[model samples]
Target: VLTTFDLDEYVHAALRAGASGFLLKDARPDELLAGIRAVAGGDAVIAPALTRRLLDEFARYGSAPTDDPRVDRLTEREREILVAIGRGWTNGEIAARLVLSESTVKTHVGRVLAKTGARDRVQAVIFAYDLGLARPSVR
Candidate 1:
């Protein structure tokens, strides 16, 4: 997905619709190529500048989705992993913060995605936001 619109809803919808990457129209040519390669290699990407903006928008105004029966399957650890993912935390960050090994964090992340029916980490981020499980803290 490449567009001039940086609205959070579009970003969320694109990821939810299973877009492998989203880049702004103004992105550098090299960045665009890199994003294409990343997506082709089975990784997901989002425009760097939009990451924080997306998080802030979700924290401020995202609405809850309809009840998800699968959510009942998450363990407490997996729930925490979802929130960390929603805050845009990397796997290493989640491991460190949760005092778990990186492999353990990975497993928990996998469970969270499976339970939530999210196709990828980006989708899981949207799930967390929609469930009101994640929010920005005042600094």
Candidate 2:
């Protein structure tokens, strides 16, 4: 997505609509092409300048991790795995942190995605963010 608007709300809407990448209209030609290629390759991207604000929005506004019923179906262990996924941890990282095998972590992740109705890891991450189960670390 290339647009002149720098508003956070629009960015959020686009992301919610499954935009694989976002770039400002002012982005360099190379950057635009790369973003397109990355999106085409089934990766997501966000403009560098908007990344901090996007993270901040998650940190500043997130609430109700405990109260949300969207996570009600998850087991306690699965919830932990979801939070780790939301923190952008790899399966290996989650395995190390949780003292579990990589296969176990992968299985937990699959269960989390299925239980939460998330189509993929990226959707699971978004779900975690929306449910306030994960947060960006403040520096």
Best by TM-score: 1
* Range of the 10 consecutive residues with the lowest summed lDDT in candidate 1: 64-73
Clash total of candidate 2? 0
Q: Rate the local accuracy (lDDT) of all candidates.
A: 0.83, 0.83
Question: Could you tell me the TM-score of candidate 2?
Answer: 0.72
Q: Model 2 clash pairs?
A: none
Candidate 1 matches the true fold with a TM-score of 0.81
* lDDT, residue 137, candidate 2: 79
lDDT of 2: 0.83
For residue 19, model 2's alpha carbon misses the true position, in angstroms, by 3.3
Residue 20 lDDT in candidate 2 = 69
Give the runs in model 1 whose Cα sits over 4 Å from its true position. Answer: 4-9, 64-67
Candidate 1 lDDT, 1-139, residue by residue in tens: 9999988779878887888789999999999999999888756789999877876777778896556666778887887888899887888999999899999998898888878888778788778788877776655
